[model samples]
Target: MAANNLRGQVLSLYSRLLRMSRNWNATNPAETIVERQYIKEETMELFRKNKHHSEPFIIKECLKEAEARMTMAEHYRNPYPRPVNLPKRSFSKKEGKKIGKAIQKFNEQSRPIYIRSTDDAVGRSS
Candidate 1:
């Protein structure tokens, strides 16, 4: 099954990351300790946090991101994640308060909701 394959991939990637953390060799002597600790902590935190997710596309995206990060680290000889340039948002105080309330309401929803991917639809209908 596809889920089984994804599970295997996740386990393999997790083990690889753990091993990498233990064996990390930094190009910059000053960054060795910081980068190693970061790799281990980030790996543990992100994997544990997302372990409960059942969405196949979400899992695949995470796996791709991890692989890309690993490749980038090897190429750059840096284990830390690259800084993202997020766009700045400028909301008025009133708008910000309203947005905050909306976010809180969304988070407090009682039931979990998921959008089924096309793959799920096709597989289930067969």
Candidate 2:
């Protein structure tokens, strides 16, 4: 039956999303749990919202879009939470603005120095 087929497709998509969600991480365990719960709730809600659609063309198109979304999410999802222990900045917003150029200068100091010479060094003595 068409209804049965549609239900199966929706279930399959939902499970795929859950598996995908497992690969995501948040900065901490509590955040991770919250994120996973949000993902599950949003997914179930989307599928439930469309549960009554019976038209063949609509179902087909919806399935195709779902597949595309799954592929994109799998490919482009963040690999992991950025480290939770990065050094916290002590600067206030105003301090940060005041020291912006100093920060830029500090970063630039790390760059490799480059020297340009017009003469071939081997041919001429210093």
Candidate 3:
């Protein structure tokens, strides 16, 4: 927040912009890659162009503008913040027709693991 530390503040903002940009995973891999590269190039260019600025007031204004750009990129650039949900294929669909097999369902109560005693009727909880 200090006017004298504009350099550090801008650098922090730049890093944050890059970090948040990586989280964007649109339906297409190419789009995400392009957007990420754009964020990096844009941020670097903006900071590099204003590196020689010495006026505290100008520097403060520049940082504010950079912060606003970062905010817009974070919220507006990517309409979908959460990752795209991919559809899952069933076991039969994944494997070829030759190897396709249906999932098996089993009843545990019918298994031999359970033992019924002669007191089955007398031991009834009801």
Name the best candidate (by lDDT): 1
Q: Which candidate would rank higher by TM-score, 1 or 3?
A: 1
> Mind giving the per-residue lDDT tens digits that candidate 3 earns over 8-44?
7877877887776677664567698877776677666
Which structure is stronger by lDDT: 2 or 3?
2
Question: Candidate 3, which segments miss by more than 4 Å at Cα?
Answer: 1-4, 27-29, 79-126
lDDT (10s digit) by residue, model 1, range 18-104: 888888889988888888899898788768766877889878866876787777787889876665432243222364355565544
Which digits, one per residue and each the tens of the lDDT, describe model 2 over residues 28-118? Answer: 6667776777656655655666567778766665566556555644565532222222134433236435557665454333221211011
Model 2: how far is 49 from its true place, Å? 0.4
Q: Against the hidden reference, what TM-scores do the models get?
A: 0.65, 0.48, 0.52
Q: What's model 3's lDDT at 91?
A: 31
Please give the RMSD to the true structure for each candidate, in Å. Answer: 10.1, 21.1, 25.0
Worst lDDT window (10 residues) for model 3? 110-119
Give the range of the ten consecutive residues with the poorest summed lDDT in model 2. Answer: 115-124
The TM-score of predicted model 3 comes to 0.52
Tell me the deviation in Å of residue 41 in model 3. Answer: 0.6
The models' CA-based lDDT, in order, is 0.67, 0.53, 0.52
Off by over 4 Å in 1: 85-126
